[model samples]
Target chain A: EAAVTQSPRNKVAVTGGKVTLSCNQTNNHNNMYWYRQDTGHGLRLIHYSYGAGSTEKGDIPDGYKASRPSQENFSLILELATPSQTSVYFCASGDVGGRAEQFFGPGTRLTVL
Target chain B: EQQVQQSPASLVLQEAENAELQCSFSIFTNQVQWFYQRPGGRLVSLLYNPSGTKQSGRLTSTTVIKERRSSLHISSSQITDSGTYLCAMGRNSNNRIFFGDGTQLVVKP
Candidate 1:
């Protein structure tokens, strides 16, 4: 199985506080993505990395940053968290091409208070 | 604008009943993937149907490239099958992924 794991399955952060969510995958894939899921809106892409040392903004990348320091690790950063940022974040990894299906992580539940 | 759209935002069914989920792309797409999301959990890839028909377990997916649409048929659904079904479309030759809002399913015993 392609395993994608996330850290701090649950988190609570103060407004304007810094928050970081980490993900690790053993799939050895080249593409990784960060998505936030909210009610009514469903899941929206926040950021994605094509490979190490590269990151691209998704449809909704405001107030979010991504880091791909290595092929196995990807992180989503929030420099100034707000109540509106409270939601579940998911990380996914896939093969080099879009034809391959992405394997998603367990997801991190973030609550910005 | 939502590039990928799914019909019947929610569904409720009884055990052993069948369910059909639909997905359509706003524009042309070369790759289509279906996923299952448990309540407050991760997504599991159900079928990666680009075109034609594919089956896995009690699930069957069909995609028609010319029509730019896909459907998932669930036969004899169980309570464990209750979850949200998501559809993702990838632009032709490009890897950009677009997601649908998903169809929530609830199965009652």
Candidate 2:
């Protein structure tokens, strides 16, 4: 099975602080994604990357930026965190095609106070 | 407008009972996937049935691309099955997946 891991599984930050969540996958998948999960919204995509150094905005990309520095590492950056940004973030890695099954990391829960 | 919709926002079931979940898409899609998330845990892919029927263990997923709908049936529910079930559809144009609000399931012992 594919292995995906996220750092700082639980986080607490003051408002206006910078928060960065990191993800690493060992499956060597070409596509990686970042998403935030809320109560009613389910999972909203923030950003995704096709490969290293390529980033594309997803349905909900505002207030979040993504970086794919390498094939195995993808990161989600919150430059200026706010109270409303407190939510659970997930990282996923998938193969090249649309029908490919995605493998997700454990998830990172961020609390902005 | 929501691209994907899931029925029964929440459901409570007794142990040994069967649970059925439904998912419908508003747009044309041939890629459908089912996921399960334990309470405060990671999202785990259960089935990737874009079309036809597939089964794994106690979970069975059937997808009808032409009808733009899919269903997941869980037989003999257990207390460990309590969590959220999410359905997602993939867009071929942009390679983006849209998720439904999910069906929260609670199983009673």
**Lowest summed lDDT window (length 10), candidate 1 chain B:** B89-98
Question: Which is the leading candidate under lDDT?
Answer: 2
lDDT by residue for model 1 (B5-102), tens: 89889999999999999999888776889999988989999988889999999999999989999999999999999999999988745476788989
Question: Looking at every candidate separately, what fraction of the true A–B Cα contacts under 8 Å does it contain?
Answer: 0.61, 0.59
List the pairs of residues colliding in candidate 1.
none
CA lDDT, every model vs. true structure: 0.91, 0.91
Evaluate residue B47 in candidate 2 and report its C-alpha lDDT on the 0 to 100 scale.
Answer: 92
State the lDDT at A90 in candidate 2.
95
Give stretches of model 1 more than 4 Å off. A98-100
Docking quality level of the chain pair in candidate 1 = medium
A-chain TM-score of every model: 0.97, 0.96
User: lDDT per residue, candidate 2, A1-113, as tens digits?
Assistant: 67999999999999999999999999999899998888767788899999999999988889998999999999999999999999999999987656656889999999999
Candidate 2 positional error at A101, Å: 2.6
Model 2 chain B: weakest 10-residue lDDT segment is: B90-99
